[model samples]
Target: MPTLESFFAPQDNIALENEAAEQEAHLIAEVEETFMKLIEIREAKFMDMMDAREKKYRALLN
Candidate 1:
């Protein structure tokens, strides 16, 4: 014999909210990692270009 309160229990979205939060956290982590990789690649490219320029200048000087 169920009570009227049980029949009219509130339907909360706690579970859905938690699931969405978890997904958002995962996406943020992935985006951060990708951004770090992009920064590393940019640095590497800049270093390579500087090295090439230095070699050209040294050749011109000699």
Candidate 2:
């Protein structure tokens, strides 16, 4: 005895939407964290390069 109303469960839509929103938020947080890590890596690399360059200049002066 399947009625037309049984084909669609409207009550489940809210839960589904909430779950999707939670997943999206989690993904966004992960992306932000990854981006911060990349920035930190880039900054550290730049600092290392600058230090190396400064040492080279100091060696040339002496």
Candidate 3:
């Protein structure tokens, strides 16, 4: 039982678009943070392995 004017209001579209944009921004931020943390963990593991290999090689040399 709603009128056409109420259904097709201009402000409604703007509000919906703004809400979608905010949600997208929030999701992007979360994904970026997760990726950074993953990268840091990978780097730390790689460094640890490299150190272990170097120590083993030095022990063999000596």
Candidate 4:
């Protein structure tokens, strides 16, 4: 029986390299999307707090 190394020895290494590169690119894109969503959520919360503060100050002034 042929060993695992012998079986893979004749295969094109470039295909494996390309597959790894594609997976890495996909992972990076997912991470970037997640980061951007988190930033947007933070910004929304900050805006909400600012609006609340403005409402409170206006009520106090009135």
Candidate 5:
């Protein structure tokens, strides 16, 4: 049995390596998408904060 397994081991290893590479690439893409969404949310919040501050300053001046 061991001898039979050894004979097929190289093919099995190649298949596993390909699967791992595919999974890694998928995970990296997901992480990048999530990061971009977070950045967009942050920029929106910052813009809102600046607008509110500008309104407050105008009210003070008036």
Candidate 6:
């Protein structure tokens, strides 16, 4: 049977490296997607608050 350390040899090492890189890319993409969604939600909420504030100020002026 092969030792555990044997897996770290050239061929197997390359495979692990590729898998790790692929996973990293996938995680990065997921994070970016979630961040963009959060940004959109934050902007929408800010706009809503600004609109409400404008209405309140207008009411006070009347």
* TM-scores of all predicted structures: 0.80, 0.84, 0.86, 0.80, 0.83, 0.85
RMSD of 4: 2.7
Give the higher-TM-score candidate: 1 or 3: 3
The per-residue C-alpha lDDT of model 2 at residue 27 equals 100
Better of 3 and 6 by lDDT: 6
Error of 4 at 33 (Å): 0.6
Better of 1 and 6 by TM-score: 6
- By the lDDT metric, which is better: model 3 or model 4? 3
Number of clashing residue pairs in every model?
A: 0, 0, 0, 0, 0, 0
14-51: candidate 2 lDDT, tens digit per residue: 77778999999999999999999999999999999999
In model 2, pairs of residues that clash are: none
| Residue lDDT tens for model 5, 2-61 | 675576678897998899999999999999999999999999999999999999999999
Ranking by lDDT: 6, 3, 5, 2, 4, 1
User: What value does the lDDT take at residue 52 in candidate 2?
Assistant: 100
> How much is the lDDT of residue 9 in candidate 4?
42
lDDT of 3 at 57: 100
Model 4, TM vs. native: 0.80
When summed lDDT is taken over every stretch of 10 residues in candidate 1, the lowest stretch is 4-13
> What's the TM for model 2?
0.84
What is the C-alpha local distance difference test score of each model?
0.87, 0.92, 0.94, 0.89, 0.93, 0.95
Model 3 residue 10 distance off true place after TM-score fit, in angstroms: 1.3
Ranked candidates, highest TM-score first: 3, 6, 2, 5, 1, 4
lDDT score for residue 10 of model 1: 52
Lowest summed lDDT across 10 adjacent residues in model 5 is found at 1-10
Q: Candidate 3: where are CA atoms >4 Å away?
A: 1-8
Residue 39's C-alpha lDDT in candidate 1?
A: 100
